[model samples]
Target: MIAEVMGAICVLIGIPFFLTGTLGLLRLPDIYTRLHALTKADNVGLGFIILGLAIQSGSWLEVARLFLIWFLVLLASATSCHLIAQAAFEKNIKPWTKEE
Candidate 1:
């Protein structure tokens, strides 16, 4: 019962972050800001999705696959974000700071 409830909650939680990423990607002013939004959404979305999947799965193999997928998402997101950030830095994109 608890696992079922938690699974529902986790799945619901994942949706918002995914939506946020989509909206931010569409609405953010520039590349760097968009990237920031992307990272936040991607990480949280993946986390929640994995958590939900883990909670819902009955078999060990299924859970392990979810874990593997989570691990790959983390690895890929980190590497890709790092490269994007590096490129932004090299291009001298000014971060949206509050100093203005």
Candidate 2:
């Protein structure tokens, strides 16, 4: 019962992060900021989700698999974010800055 409650709370907590990430993706002004918001928020949200699922998992193997999937996603997102930023930089796409 406690595990279920905790898992539910964790999932609830993660939902906002996902929503905020999507909002940021759509609302942020620049590519860099959008990527930053999306990647960081989504990663944290995914972590919370994975943690909740792991907590509710019936076996260690399932928990380990969840963690492994999370790890892979982290690696992939980071790598892709970096590559995209680098490409943008190469193209002389500047980050958004406040006009003084």
Candidate 3:
């Protein structure tokens, strides 16, 4: 019972990070800011979700798989973000700046 409750709590905690990232993606002015918001929030959110699932898993093997999935996601997100940012830079896309 306690483990279930804790897992639920962890999942709940992760939800807001995902929402915040979505908000940032919609509201932020530039690609860099959006990527920053998305990658950071998603990484933390995914970590929390994986932790929750791992805790609720029936066996150590399941927990390990959860962690592996999380790691792969992290790796993929980082690589993709870097590639996108580099493409933007190569294309001469400037970050948004506040008007003076």
Model 3 ranges with Cα > 4 A deviation: none
| Per-candidate TM-score against the hidden true structure | 0.83, 0.97, 0.97
lDDT string for model 1 (19-40, tens) is 9988999998777788878887
Q: Worst ten-residue run, lDDT, model 3?
A: 49-58
Q: Residue pairs in steric clash, candidate 3? A: none
Cα lDDT, model 2, residue 26: 91
Q: Give the TM-score of candidate 2.
A: 0.97
Model 2 agreement with the true structure over 2-98: per-residue lDDT tens digits: 9998988888888899999999999999999999988999999999999998888889999999999999999999999999999999999999998
Q: What ranges in model 2 sit over 4 Å off?
A: none
- Supply the global lDDT for candidate 2: 0.93
For candidate 3, lDDT tens digit of each residue in 1-100? Answer: 8888899889889989999899999999999999999999989998898888887888999998999999999999999999999999999999999999
Q: Rate the local accuracy (lDDT) of all candidates.
A: 0.87, 0.93, 0.93
